[model samples]
Target: MKKGRIILIDDDRDHLRAASDWLTVNGFEVLSFDRADDAFKAIIDQPPDLVLTDLRMPGVDGMTLLSSVVRKCPGLPVILLTAHGDVSLAVEALKRGGEDFIEKPYDAERLVGVLSKAIEKSRMSQEIGRLQRLVVQQDKEVGSIIGDSTAIRSLRQRIAALAQVDIDVLIIGETGTGKELVAQALHYQSHRAPAPFVAINCSALPESIFESEVFGHVKGAFTGALSERQGKFEHATGGTIFLDEIEAMPLPFQAKILRVLQERVVERLGENRLRPVDVRIVAAAKTDLSAEIAAGRFREDLFYRLASVDVRIPPVRERAEDIEQLFRHFASLAARRYGRPEPQVPPSLVVRLLQQEWRGNVREVKARAERFALGLDEEQPQQSAFSIEAPLPERVSHYEARLILAALGINHGNTAQTAADLGIPVRTLNEKIKRYGLRYSGET
Candidate 1:
């Protein structure tokens, strides 16, 4: 396999020919130029992975060419070929810009090894940058939010529309509903897409460093303050910041967060100056804000501020038609990863899958699909009844609505109490009532 492309330059024709012969024999495409200008002409037409040039030349010396290459392709690695007496100059060239250097009488193996290492390092950096850009591109679309159901389609459209409007957003969803994915889509499609999209898990950050992490800290701000640091807000300036599990944020910190939103700035720890910031907040929580507010665990004011626009991601049960499709997709991916053939789905398994309630939502469905693909789902049980004939989502909603109605009836039409009995939040229960177009008697 060809290692990669390299441009070799030396004023001595014999030296250029020798280096070219050795490199070509060792699996590299060597382009040898006897003059610096000749090599630069080729470098301008098509930049190579590595540049190898002599330190002393008639014109456009090695240092000048290396500087020019550095200016044009900052990431490209350049290695200098120097004489035994020019070791100091070679070291200076490295300090100036060159990646490494080898003496003219160096062994062919040592030269090839250095060249290979430099080219590989350059390629690795290039690959990382490409992948990072790809990740940003993927976030710009609905690629990560997979589903073809009507609810999912409508949600996608709403997300696209919301991306254009710069406003704080509140995402409401059950556990495993891909709330973070929605937040990413919002950031990548917005006008601030080029800026950073920083994500923080509110529940994961402890109280000890919460302030310093969110608002940053100046040097000597507190104990163990080694250097000035940029906080999540500063990193996300002019872009989006995703706060997952917003309900779990400490009450005092929640108040500060609200202030930051209102003030459009943050004061780092031990800093007297407030740095202005332009950021859009996208907050997510699995719990109901209304219940949290009623319970006095969350600030109602903060809720209103973060929820300038609200996005609700429907649970898997509500979009159950996507279950089979999601299952097949995940199974294929798992099979590829595991080096296993795609498992065949039996008709009975299809019925069994749709019959059971996916309590963990899409996340649970994904896990079960991977297990099924690995042939480890034989012990899993299926329960209850819902028609596979009707449009799958309709059947799911119909069954769910019936269950909620029954639960309400059993609880004598008390939504809060019924919600507790059903193991769902009152807010979620109310939304279900509205979605199913149902009314309970003896209720206002």
Candidate 2:
């Protein structure tokens, strides 16, 4: 391995010689300079991997040299050396972009360790910048969307055409079908692209706070309401509000939303004044709202208002042709995320990926790809002990039940801890336990 080159700058000749000799003996190429000007000149001639400089020096102090090195060779790592009482100045040096700081009479081993870590970090940063540029180029060449399936092609065309319109849009798709990505493409390709593109998930919030969350509320609207809040609609004014899982919104909230859509105005909770909000509504739903409306669960008028322009995204299973492209994209992303050399997907893995039902859609596929990159998905499948396989819904239910049981076990049968771990309310977990007939072994 090639040894890293280091430049040391200090007015103390004995200290420079001692540090330089120590580093050189440890298999580093060290250059020592008593003046900051000479060190900067040497750096300009040939930049070193790292620079160690003292905080105080006669003409052209360490801080001035640090600034010059950063401006000339921004990638170089610089470590500051300071006396015990000058620790504050060393900290200020770090704030000014010094890689790290070491106190005078520092431990030899600790100084070397810090230098090694800083050099490694600098190299990693360079590699990441290079990879990011490549990704940007690839994105430009293939457009923002990563697939070439007929469904995706049609969706892109529809998005392009819809970008010219100012009408409200409703995107219907199962979870993880990239509905938010589609919404982003629409906004970026539209006239409102320069403005804010805010998003919120209707189902992520409870019904009790839904009104104040969707529409702004004044101070003292309710208990614990200490300050006035600008809701999603007000924040998204002059841009777009992408409401995900809109079908999960309560009927009363749906009625209020319908009035907002019709009148282009909203009234803050606990306030009589009405505020006009100019925002294009782009709503998403995991299920068909028409059926929900027929079942009296959703407001018909709100459905019509939101569905003025509708886009249905096909699930990953329906767009099999796009599987290979998506797999490659996700694999690359995972490799970059894990700081590993990009791995190749075997032909067998590709075939298996295409054949899978992918019930969870693109999100599931990406997750599996990440696991594969991490070598966690390399286990061979063993034959089951049972002869019959369960149906999809039955298998899902069985998995859910087992998960809840495991969480309960980990929490030592504490329902509150289990519910918190599972990210569900205690009441909901209790209901599920009762519905599934799950019992604590200790109780019996």
**Cα lDDT over the full model 2:** 0.83
For model 2 the TM-score comes to: 0.56
Give model 1 RMSD, 1 decimal: 15.3
Instruction: Work out the TM-score per prediction.
Output: 0.62, 0.56
Off by over 4 Å in 2: 1-143, 379-444
Give residue 249's error in model 1 in angstroms.
0.5
Model 2 Cα shift for residue 221 (angstroms): 1.8
Candidate with the greatest lDDT versus the true structure: 1
Q: What is the lDDT of every predicted structure here? A: 0.86, 0.83
Give the total clashing residue pairs for model 1.
0
How would you encode candidate 1's per-residue C-alpha lDDT over 30-55 as one tens digit per residue? 99988888888899889998999999
lDDT for each residue of candidate 2 in 295-403, tens digit (9 for 90 to 100): 9999888888898899999999889999888877876665564454676777888888878998889888877775555444563132322234767777666657756
Candidate 1 residue pairs in clash (backbone atoms < 3 Å): none
